[model samples]
Target chain A: MFSGAQVSLYPMTDDFVGVILKAITALEPYRPDFRIETDDVSTLLVGPPDQLFPAMRDLFVTAAGSGVHCVLAATVSRGCPGEPDDPICTPINDVHYGQPLEERIAAAIQQVEAAPKTGQIVAAQFSLYPLGSGHHMDEIYGCIEFLKNSGVFDRSKNFCTKLRGDAGAVFATLSEAFLRFGAPQGHVALDLKVSANSPTAV
Target chain B: MFSGAQVSLYPMTDDFVGVILKAITALEPYRPDFRIETDDVSTLLVGPPDQLFPAMRDLFVTAAGSGVHCVLAATVSRGCPGEPDDPICTPINDVHYGQPLEERIAAAIQQVEAAPKTGQIVAAQFSLYPLGSGHHMDEIYGCIEFLKNSGVFDRSKNFCTKLRGDAGAVFATLSEAFLRFGAPQGHVALDLKVSANSPTAV
Candidate 1:
């Protein structure tokens, strides 16, 4: 299934231009593993689903490392029916794709537990969409349940769920939510916003 | 039906605090029409759906008038089954609800045509979720058709659709897209991000 994200980073400083440019270089190592394109609005990273979070994590960690308030906005999707599949994002199979809801939740939790620690702490909120499906609510509810047990779950807001923890685990939780709950090979997306070193009291 | 939005404004300037505080004053007039609250992360606005866009438009216009880069992030929703209905946001009846998709698209276009031009130019991108319905994509595709004719339609990006025009038409387009698509009584959501005077090349 095809999967990708359009990501933009904002640094809250007069030196924003330098911070943003320097941070994007973190995606360089992942270039061979994915197809990355940058435009005026955002950077599009397309390729395998598993490599996606790590790439984003590095980009964010690098930017946040500047010790200035920073925010990253990302729109992530997988298996969108309307979008054509790309060979670079293919050949990968999810063993738990067709598992029962309970089983999938269990598998997702295990994935998060094994995620490598990136050390940087961050807060994130995301609204997931499992589109064109009759049982979308069930999937969303199940995702909520999984998130609560993911150790990074913070709280549920009006339009999205919040999470906070090490960047590694936080990104892992997001990855599982986007992949596990929605119908595999169907249209699904996540409207993700993340902040690191935010000045506001949280 | 219940409707509300969680909105966060980001002013891309060193004096962000001043810009945000000054822009918030624009919401005062709409306070009588909606229940409003501000926290560290965002401002919560709940009220009649029709008035939502106007309130947001004024806020954006005020901030953009400062001639600094600004971005507004809003998560808007209506008729969510999981959320309790608030009386403050009640009594809204969309006349076009339950109509054929084509008719709804035409109605939405009409609404945009009558929108008041705010003179502030803006660009926005939003993803609408009409959850748990088998025809969700049909509604989404229908919305796409409406946006193309909305007078604010920009180009469609990878994860969300973009719009650019006077703040009035852009915001009106967003309101119509939310109210006109999806099941009126079922859960629906929009992840909206709008930019005004963005210093970066758009």
Candidate 2:
């Protein structure tokens, strides 16, 4: 299966140019592992789904370490037909879809528990879109149930579900939600926002 | 009807605290018109649906004018049962939601065309969810049709539709999309991101 994301970082400072440039270097360690491109709107990162959030966490941690507030907005997707299938954009795991929903939930939880800890506590929110699914809501509800036990699950917000924890688990939880739920071959989209070192974070 | 949004601004600089404080002052002019609260996570702006975007634009423009890259993340919603009805959060316009879908589309376009121009250009993307709408994808597709002709439509992005234009028209288009589509009384949610003054802008 194919996986990738379109991400943009906004830094609130006069030296934003400097900040953004410096932050992306955090992704350098992951280079050649993914095809990355930066455009006027957002940067495109295509590669293994497992590395998507870890790469993002490294980048944001660098930005946040500047002792400034930074926000990352991203749309993570897997199995979207609109995107061209590139051999480089392949999943690292054996993803056998059509497994029973309960099994997927158990596997997803195990994955979250085993995620590497980034040690950077962050708060994130996301809304899942399971397009073309015959029973999208069922898929959504199932995901929600899995999130409640995902260790990082925060609370139910007005529109999106919230998650807070070490950057590693938070992102791992998100990756699982995006990849494991919804139709196996249908398009699934995740609207994701992550924040680090915010003054308002409780 | 209850209409409001949860918004947060992140400034990437050592002076993020100062920058955020300075920017929120812009919303001072809109005060008393809405019930606003700021917390560790975000600020809640509850008021007439029409003023939601303008208020955000004012706050964002102020932050962007500092000659830095700033990004705003917001989730706007109307008529969610989870929220309590507040007279303070009233609709400025006579929203007859049950009107024909075509009529709603026309009115939405007219609203965008008549929007007050903020003179600042910004790019925004949002995904609308008509939670209980039996035909949610149909509603999404219909919203897409309206957006193509919205004058501010930028492109069909992977997960969400993109809009770029004067802050006024761009936000107006977003407001219309959030309010006009989906089930009239059913729960509807929008996940939104807006950015300005980015060095990466083409």
Candidate 3:
């Protein structure tokens, strides 16, 4: 079982570079338990459930607190039959492999900070897989019901719901959903993504 | 902003009661900030993102570390046009609301501990909503790609993927996906769920 996620953030302000840097930097504290990698498209976090969730929560919360509209997109996966039994998939209780997570993340963020600022807003897409549990569709429906009852889901749209206003609130909602659906009975995996923004000026 | 998540854990072992009790008790330290509520169905933690996420992380890690197969289902949401500005939704920086989370969680866990043990595995369903962003379909695609590449997505199924094996690995993957997609740009929401089981005799 290999667990990992790729995350992309789009900050809707001139200081977008700063916001992204701050978000990535926040994960530095969790370096002891996580292995983080960043490329041009997204940043990847690999580690145990305990460390990974808390680190991600902290990262997103820090980024959202910048008081600017932004969107964070990610895709998480585990229990793939196809995954290779390499060092990267080693259990958390074992010795770590590869470069230190904090240094890698810091270097990546620095590069982003130094890059020329882009005034344009970013829009990206994401998905999750292996949402199987023999009754995946049912579980998906149940998850939808749970979200609807939570009061954060707007039913006005066709496939996606609108999460408006505060960034903290949005992150909270997303965190809950991911934790619940991660390891379902009968071995289920999921695919999901979002495009978020502050309310546009009316 | 107020951030919160409602989690329900179903352990597929005879010691289900103990597992749930231990997980809830794990959050006692964060009583200062969270408002925790538990019924027969789920435990809801509402507060600042900082407190809520850390608390949930601790709880799940403790439960998963027990080495029993369990399914933890949750739904998270925030900032919807339909949500009432009740005390539960109050910002973390504001005055307190309701009873203390620690006391409530303790009482609930105690009740579970006292209940007669049911030696049956639990199967449940959950859903999340407000996954509305005009381009939700695209985000879904992105999430799928990320999961596929993560090496844990079980593509054996037609519509969903299967995440099996260690609870920690499954949790790590799900947590990453939820945190990322929960708040995408253009105001998107999500829906998902899971079911898990301990390793059966070969």
TM-score, every prediction = 0.94, 0.84, 0.38
Candidate 2 stretches with Cα past 4 Å from truth are A1-3, A29-35, A47-50, A79-90, A97-102, A131-141, B1-3, B28-35, B46-48, B79-90, B99-102, B130-138
| Cα RMSD, model 1 | 2.0
Residue-pair clashes, model 3: 51
Per-residue accuracy of model 3 over A1-202 as CA lDDT, tens digit each: 5555655554545455678788888888877666676643346676653244456556666765675655554555454433433345344433222333343333333332333322222221212222323333443444455445443454422223333323333344444344344233122233333333334321
Clashes of each: 0, 4, 51
lDDT of 2 by residue, A42-102 (tens): 7889898767888888888888777666778887877765467778767666777667789
> Comparing candidate 2 with candidate 3, which one achieves the higher DockQ?
2
Model 3 misplaced regions, further than 4 Å: A50-53, A85-134, A161-172, A182-202, B1-202
The A-chain TM-scores of all the candidates are 0.96, 0.93, 0.62
Per-candidate local distance difference test: 0.84, 0.79, 0.44
True contacts kept of each: 0.60, 0.36, 0.00
Of the pair 1 and 3, which is ahead by lDDT? 1
Model 1 chain B lowest lDDT segment of ten: B88-97
